[model samples]
Target: MSFVTDHILKNPPVLLGLIAMIGLIVQRKTFAEVVKGSLTAVFGMVALTAGVNMLTGTIAPINTAVQTQLGVQVADGLSDVTFTAEYGGTVGLAMFLD
Candidate 1:
């Protein structure tokens, strides 16, 4: 139960997929349609995640270089923060609620 709650239920991609599936089901869609919709939602979430990671990866180096040139220092304990690591759950919950 914990595993299901922590992994499958809490996961944003799966939660989005489930929402898609449920919505389709409520609309009286066929099984195939529901499956396709759910898969599309999940895949879309995966793609969005990948794009964010790529953008962050591209920006981090430039940000570091600018900070170095300007003699700016990152605040304490914030040097390693990443978007997904910081707000992934909140993003997922917001998506689910919407």
Candidate 2:
């Protein structure tokens, strides 16, 4: 599932699936009192996500300000650091496991 659509969307289906499971929990808590409660749980998640998106919008500016005001610089985002090495051995993971 991830291999096919990991790059397609920012939130990804995994997040939605998790939200749905939690939404179910919320519905169960009230014994599924009404359909509106379940729907509200889902909508609440959407609203929460929107709020987080707004908060994240300021991260860049906040980072810049902190870096500029203070002498401390912060490293953010992904990094391209990898090491490749070839080994010649029995490759011991755990002899008992094998």
Candidate 3:
């Protein structure tokens, strides 16, 4: 049908891939090797993912303890603090301290 042809033309990659897969199947391409290779890659990625999770898990507790004991949140060196100034008075970090 014209509609099917138009749809295929609009999505060339999908159309080409579908045709290639059909051809491979007609030519008797066994998917056994492909499945094995994919499984191996997935296993390697799973190991790396687990290691990253463990690394973060160890650091999280230390960060929480520092914030709780200090009563201030540490984020990129900008602690949660506020300041007020009297005009024409002492200035700089010294004034903020006193």
Candidate 4:
């Protein structure tokens, strides 16, 4: 069961395909529609993931150059802020409230 859940349910492409299949089934779609929908969903996720990977690859060199030039200076008013206090209140409050 863990293997099935880990390999199938938790995989992005498989998860998207499963969701599409389930959605089509719930709507009583035809067999062709079910298969096409699931495959499209899976491929769509794969394409999106590829696009993001390309974007990050392109950005890496720019990020490195920027950091090299900027020399890791802190933001103007945030120089003394501890990491815990920096985002803790905003993220914590939003997490529970939202």
Candidate 5:
């Protein structure tokens, strides 16, 4: 049953539809009502996934353009060590008090 479980976990929309259908059936919903409710849930999830994909796709080009234009240089690990050396004692005391 590992194969079955793997497929079930991978497709969350299907799992959610199955759960909604089962809940509706247990509540003695009509056949039509069960089908409608389950399909609505599944389609809603699909639409949400599509919308998020489109949003991310649209933002990626903008992000790339901004990063390229900015020509920003980030300092390496030197700053992190310097910060700790300067403030480590104060931070350690604050944490001890907390």
Candidate 6:
């Protein structure tokens, strides 16, 4: 249905878990093994997402402090600046190249 496609399919963790389950099934794994593999994949993705979010959160304050110490100025008409807002394009390009 639309809900399944929109929610479960679009979600990376769940899609990965489904792939794991399908692979286990193809290998003739037991039910418990299939369930365990799928859950493990899902949990791993969740953990990775959590870790990235945590790292970004930790970096925000450090970025703010460095900007403050360096006396960085905000551009005109901008009320607030953020680490991502300032460096996201460069970071994205670096990531794309890598």
Best TM-score among the predictions, by candidate number: 1
What TM-score would each prediction reach against the true structure?
Answer: 0.71, 0.39, 0.38, 0.67, 0.61, 0.61
Candidate 2 segments whose C-alpha is farther than 4 A from its true place: 2-38, 78-98
lDDT of each: 0.79, 0.46, 0.49, 0.70, 0.69, 0.73
Candidate 5, residues 1-98, lDDT tens digits: the string is: 44434454345566668767878998999999999999998898789878887997899688778868997644556553466555544554443345
Candidate 1 local lDDT, residue 25: 97
Give the range where candidate 1 is weakest over 10 consecutive residues by summed lDDT: 77-86
Better of 1 and 4 by TM-score: 1
**Steric clash pairs (candidate 2):** none
For model 4, the superposed segments whose C-alpha errors exceed 4 Å read: 73-98
Write candidate 3's Cα lDDT for 1-98 as tens digits.
44544454333333434444555566676786444444555565567657877887898799899889989876563421122122112222232234
Report the error of model 4 at residue 84, Å. 23
Q: How accurate is candidate 2 locally (lDDT)?
A: 0.46
lDDT of 4 by residue, 1-98 (tens): 54544456446677668768988998999999999999999999899989988997899688778988989743555422354235444443343244
Report the Cα lDDT for residue 89, model 2.
14
TM-score of 3: 0.38
Candidate 6 residue spans exceeding 4 A from truth? 63-98
Which structure among the candidates has the greatest lDDT? Answer: 1
- The 10 consecutive residues of candidate 2 with the worst lDDT sum are 80-89
Rank the models by TM-score, top first: 1, 4, 5, 6, 2, 3
Residue 97, candidate 6: how far off, in angstroms?
27
Error of 3 at 18 (Å): 16
